[model samples]
Target: MPRRAMLRSAAVAGTAATLSLVPATASAAPNRWTPEELKDRKRVLEAGFTEAEADCWLLVVRATAAFFALPELHPLAKPEVVTAVHVIQDKLMMRPAYRKYRAANP
Candidate 1:
């Protein structure tokens, strides 16, 4: 197998091994995007993003904040996450205010 495949397999195995150690119950629930967060979604439009764009921005903002705080998620993705946030910010800022206004109106 290629090195990337090997690493992925190892990572999968590590995850499985880690998971098996945990005592789980059927009462455990998966994370769900709450109605509160959905209502909070429009707050991003204030910063000049389309509805779809705002949702994407919110996803990255929430995910990175949660991801970096969890040591279990490895530190390697930090730089990429920061770069993605910065790229989105710069892309939005470079657009004409009219463009942002149009996006906001819809």
Candidate 2:
């Protein structure tokens, strides 16, 4: 095969593989505002996130724990769970590199 044709084939194959790894639909996380989340509001505020984001983060943590408790009925792949996990991951990823390094080193 010609070099150009071979490169084009590889690019197409890589693109297809990348597309296959992406989810078909993006689902929104459920709105679950509860008074319980308020207790940690101050801490969250100090950590640079709004009360609302903190509440959602707690909810996601709760949901993830629940899923872990009962894996059969509460699959991690469920839309809400998946959204929660993604949200938590995004939040953690947004943290400063120094903080992450310190946490890892500590």
Candidate 3:
């Protein structure tokens, strides 16, 4: 499976399994990424993305990255790509704003 699909599926499975453990009033929201972090993600997606789809694509990237475990370094991609993607995803997942947003939105 594509990384994004795998992440999304895992998130769905996790949420379903944990639903009973959460308070009824709790909310789920989308994670936010920093401008710099977004820029890097944008650049990666752009390499294979069309201009019209950039915003939505970046959103998916941020969302998927936020939920999934960071991928380990791959031999094919540059070291920076792996490192940057991991950092961006980690930050998105851990940010206070993201947690709050998820609580409010989801």
Candidate 4:
């Protein structure tokens, strides 16, 4: 896998492990990955994406999921929410998490 992919995977695994402690109904508005996201992932993979590319796509999808998980989002404009979500997502899915995930998964 690409360096970025490894890092991203680590972050995802770490974040997921942490989040797993929370119940599905932990929040009234739990972020759910919709069926459309599954379809989109499949589409990306079928288009002959490299592993890193697919992981990048996963980051986007996961970020959207995280965005929905935020309770303060409803008060913001759509564009603002999008910007905030992406920014936060980037932070959460960076090298530190990636390293942790890679160590455990490997």
Measured by lDDT, the strongest candidate is: 4
Q: TM-scores of all models?
A: 0.41, 0.36, 0.25, 0.36
Model 3 lDDT per residue over 37-101, tens place: 56765674545443323443355454455545556555433343444445544544445456467
lDDT of 1 by residue, 10-79 (tens): 6445533543443252113113346766565556566566655555445555655775787656554555
* Model 3: residues with Cα > 4 Å off, grouped in runs: 1-33, 41-48, 69-106
Q: What is the lDDT of candidate 1?
A: 0.53
Candidate 4 residue runs with Cα over 4 Å from true position: 1-39, 83-106
Top TM-score model = 1
lDDT of each: 0.53, 0.51, 0.48, 0.54
The TM-score of candidate 4 is: 0.36
Instruction: In angstroms, give how far residue 49 of model 4 lies from its true place.
Output: 2.0
Model 3 scores a C-alpha lDDT of 0.48
* Residue 91 of model 2, lDDT score: 57
Better of 1 and 3 by TM-score: 1
**Clash pairs of candidate 4?**
10-97, 11-97, 11-98
Runs of candidate 1 exceeding 4 Å displacement: 1-40, 72-80, 93-106
Better of 1 and 2 by lDDT: 1
